[model samples]
Target: MEKNIQTKYWVVDGKEPDPGIIRQAGEIIRNGGLVAFPTETVYGLGASALDDNAVEGIFRAKGRPQDNPLIVHVADMDRVWELVSGVPARAAGLMEKFWPGPLTVILRDGGVAAKKVTAGLDTLALRMPDHPVALALIRAAGVPVAAPSANLSGRPSPTTAEHVRNDLSGRLDAILDGGPAGLGVESTVVDLSGETPVLLRPGGITPGQIESVTGRILLDPSLEPGAVIPGKPRSPGMKYRHYAPAAPLVLVEGTPSRVTGIVRQMLEENLLRGKRVGVLCREENAGLYPGAAVVGAGAGGEPGETASKLYAALRRLDQLGVDLILAEGVEPRGVGLAVANRLRRAAGKIINTGQLHE
Candidate 1:
């Protein structure tokens, strides 16, 4: 991280980012300075995709590994074409359907983006964010922006400008505060640079939703819980432990009743040990845990709701200064897959009640 650098902060309307403020932010990017801005999914630490030095700054600011690639954000199809070697028919179809949303399509690099952005890979990930502020800032910059989640590496991804400020206050050049991100997770990454379209990382866009567009896509093996990733990661969040909070987190998975039972037992054990315990659970079960610092992530265990509130809940628990956090796992379906993936990666340990015998 850069030392003692001052960060400029600005609050703007999410629906309509002030042109003047966006222009100023854009100028910072044009000059190879880092800027943290909001996307529909999460806030991104952005720099010019074409500038290697600027792209390197993103890695430096977040302490991110250079081997994990960054996503390039563009405002329009023209810019997308300028950066990718070719858009396959399936990719084109996906772009038509999911562009300007929480989907990232990886294609063969056209050799236009900075080498640092692709992390020396032959492919590049690109997406058009579905937020007015993101679009406006990219348009104002007049260059493709290479970005990764704005928070410090391995922390929960920022869902609001305040989260960005908390993690990256003095490390970056500017922050365009466009309110809270609509989705609490990062974009869904689809790798089309291969023979078969592969889901590199699940996010707000679900497997069912992507398969609806591109016939049955393959989930990357790395998506499996506790699986090891070989070589470099083709996309962000694939090779590293991400979305973790300062406190150690333990995730419990099984039938809701079983998980609830296990978490309650663990919570009691921790409290007895004189440790502060925090519980991340569904809204319906908020009252079940006593004495522990409990946070309800979503209502009725709804996938979308859980995802949109997951990071905030984690950050909140950390703020409450819990010594340990116990998160309840959601079903790995729809957006819940993304939520579960993040929790698995964030957790220091995972207990599957199904794997435990009475």
Candidate 2:
């Protein structure tokens, strides 16, 4: 807990992991210290799930709220039953379809295991992360890991290990530097605790994908301010303003022309008020806002590429010291839905610009 405590970070690449680095990361988890590592989704700040003291360290390191439960990450499907009490029939089916990918299922709290991870809730959110480095560390540590995004809570999730180092360098015991996260968004969290599977939070996996596997429509909970659902949280991103940057953010949604018009209008107004501004948009979309410093993330029309660059773009824009950020919203389909969801959260204000005249 010393302010000047030294932490080691090891950079690993691809499916093959460095055994020495994995061993060190495992040691840190075993000792109740925090270790940040990359998942296929976002990089996760991890600690031993069964160790109460280690779980506490994750909360302290991330400055996360205790009420907001952490997702338990396991190495593989075989270990799923060990963490949750009864894997409901629907949960079993979904796991069969989406295990080892960007899907998190909420299950009945398996008493002690649930207490260690969810702070004693009757439900627990669990996932088997598909990243090799993450799996390597979990396997090496020989325990389930309770992990959330590896950045200060409410800020953008760290996609790259460097992002982790930038936001949490001195705070964590060590970081497993496993390049950049592939999906670059949080996992799609689904609640299988109910009769009908509910889509708690959308991420790398789409709702259609979940429906195809479970044969049921995934429902989004009606979130009220400061309300925590009693059992398991329906979804991870519910009832919270997450993935936010330091500066104020405004989301521009609607038709292309209308969104562009609103951006131009907002930029002009901010400029008139002598406020510094930054814009995040696609290259084709950048021409809509002239004079504003634009950060482009994807080429052509690839939503996956856009999703991958989201948090990093926000971090860059935040570092630029802008007073306001104007983000263009993507179509809410496939990975684009996940991208837009994060952008909407990051953008504090959502502007429906579909009605605006260019």
lDDT string, candidate 1, 6-66, tens digits: 9999999999878999999999999999999999999999999999999989999999887
Give lDDT for model 2. 0.81
Candidate 2: tens digits of C-alpha lDDT, residues 173-284: 8988878889889999888887888877788888888888788765574322233455534455665678998989898887777787788899999988988899988768
Candidate 1, residue 166: Cα displacement in angstroms equals: 0.9
Off by over 4 Å in 2: 114-116, 222-234, 355-358
- RMSD to the hidden true structure, all candidates: 1.8, 2.7
Candidate 1 achieves a global lDDT of 0.92
Candidate number of the best lDDT: 1
**In candidate 1, which residue ranges exceed 4 Å CA deviation?**
355-358
Clashing pairs in 1: none
For candidate 2, the C-alpha RMSD (Å) to the true structure equals 2.7
